[model samples]
Target: MSLMEISCIFPVTDIKKTACFYVSKLGYKAVEYLECKEAHICLYRDKTEIILLQAQTKNIFPNRELYGYGYDAYLYTDDQEKLEKEFLEKGVKIVKPLNVTDYKNKEFVIEDIDGRWIAFGLKIKD
Candidate 1:
């Protein structure tokens, strides 16, 4: 099968807050918005996209865990310092500070409102 794109569906407690956090703070663009049976919003950054679904049930997908113990996604950026500063200025909660690592890149961690950890990194070029 040919790979195309990756999309993650997240259960949000409040759609507006989630959208605002992503669009206003995280710098993602809203690609789509729908209000049908349930409110749905799609936020995108470059090729990466995430769909936020507002379900009727209080516990959406109760059987399954949304995010694992660690980070759910890793976002690569060319300027880690700038991104970190922007996020800090916006008052976004930083789970971890930006630091250089021997293994891969300069990276940091942040958590979404829903408690999903996103690892932001800048690739170390030789």
Candidate 2:
């Protein structure tokens, strides 16, 4: 069996605010399922999908906060410059601009409304 595309699941304190951020700032379309047993908001943009779940606590603990240094998600993209430019124009909070990492990946990191760092880029070939 082959694995398909991966989707991110975020636990946010406020689903509406987080959904708004994804829609307004990050160019995503959102649909809420608040009436369900597990309330969530599904954010979709191109091939990316993010499910925002209602957090039990007021605060979220991202991987960086727990592990000291780690991105919550890494999205592979072929056009990093264009994506970065679009995000910049849309007023998205870019924590790290597009640059080649030491690991040889050209990527840019953006901080979401809940303080989760999401990187977008692809690894360079030698």
Find the candidate with the highest TM-score and give its number.
2
Q: In candidate 2, which residue pairs get closer than 3 Å at backbone N, Cα or C atoms, i.e. clash?
A: none
lDDT of 2 by residue, 1-126 (tens): 999888999999999999999999888999889999999999999999999999999889989999999999998889999999999999889999999999999999999888999999999999
> 1-126, model 1: which lDDT tens digit per residue?
898777878877778778888998888988556656666899988777889887555653321154435567777878888988999998889988999877868999887777677888977888
For every model shown, the clashing-pair count is 0, 0
The list of candidate 1 runs beyond 4 A from truth reads 56-68, 122-126
C-alpha positional error of residue 11 in candidate 1 after TM-score superposition, expressed in Å: 1.4
Compute the lDDT for candidate 1. Answer: 0.79
lDDT of candidate 2?
0.94
lDDT against the true structure, each candidate: 0.79, 0.94
What TM-score do all the candidates reach, one by one?
Answer: 0.77, 0.96
